[model samples]
Target: MAKTVNIEDAVSYFDTEVLHSGAWDEADDALRQKALNNAERILYRTYGKTYDIDDSSKWMPEEAVYEQALWMLRQDDAVQKTELGQVGVSVSGISVQMAGKPQYIAPEARRIIAEDGGSSPRSKWTVI
Candidate 1:
């Protein structure tokens, strides 16, 4: 079964739990829906497959999904960054170092995923 997180829940999460830019409130229904959809896809692709479906916490947390959705709305290039997952870049003698991994998952969300045992199998060699 595909798990879906409601946008209203995410909105409420931001409204009460997180300090945010209020972009979710400003966005139209379609755009908010798109952001939520993208957030879900990223979370599932990164962590869902490894979850034990029978576990009580099988579904991704609402707060995590909300964080990802807000991040997507705030950072337009989030999808590309998540895809790249690269650390640093240098162009024409200009070097730039990213603060952390490029995956679009928010830090708090990542922590939640880890705590919930939602991480995929991986070895040290894996960059993402």
Candidate 2:
């Protein structure tokens, strides 16, 4: 579930909205993983009728998936801005999310990675 956020305080602060501030995202990675695991289970059992058991947890809007991928890629220290400009970070040095399924990765990540300048690849999008 791309709805996973690292911050708990933020989770409470926001409208429980998919897109929220980063402050609530302070939870440890282990905790985050546990939450995501639970989310998948919940989704599979709760919304099985809406989405196949295999796909319920897997279902995500393209924009959210793209945002998630971008977040993961930026976590790597290698990503950088083009010519130290305001433009988004470059994917040339960034790495993909760890042990993540292909569904979680979005086409937009590659698009942002390939951009040359102007907009911020990382700052523009959100978890929502």
Candidate 3:
């Protein structure tokens, strides 16, 4: 699922960020690839309406997608949530309702996308 950003590019992008936790660095090739694909999918779902996903000229920011992948790796529950696509998960009587909408988005990714004018309206508007 090679989208706009590749693993090598993500690695180089994170290298310059002082706040990077090195989790992406520790992840194996398979995990990294999965994370990148998942991140891209999430972004496309979240902002696809606002941005031209198929148009390279208007491709979403690569940094935003990279930040999303890194953020997903940092979360202990991210993998389970994304993999299962579950609204809530209970383990050993501990129940956790997964965050919704904007909450699922990484902060840096959100900021980058917002700055790039990728903010999407919750509802569509049509002029008659």
RMSD of each: 5.7, 16.5, 3.8
lDDT of 1 by residue, 1-24 (tens): 225677677677777887664888
lDDT of 2 at 125: 53
Off by over 4 Å in 2: 1-19, 22-24, 55-128
Worst lDDT run of 10 residues, candidate 2, spans 112-121
TM-scores, each model vs. reference? 0.66, 0.29, 0.74
- lDDT string for model 2 (1-128, tens) is 33433334334433354363352265465654554454444433433343343454544323332334234433433233222333344478974433322232234433432342212223345586
Better of 1 and 3 by lDDT: 3
Q: Which candidate is the best by lDDT?
A: 3
Tens digits of per-residue lDDT for model 3 on 1-128?
85688988887777777365588989998999999999988888888777666888878999888888988888876555655676777889998776653256888898899899886636778999
lDDT of each: 0.70, 0.38, 0.80
Ranking by lDDT: 3, 1, 2
Give residue 117's error in model 3 in angstroms: 0.8
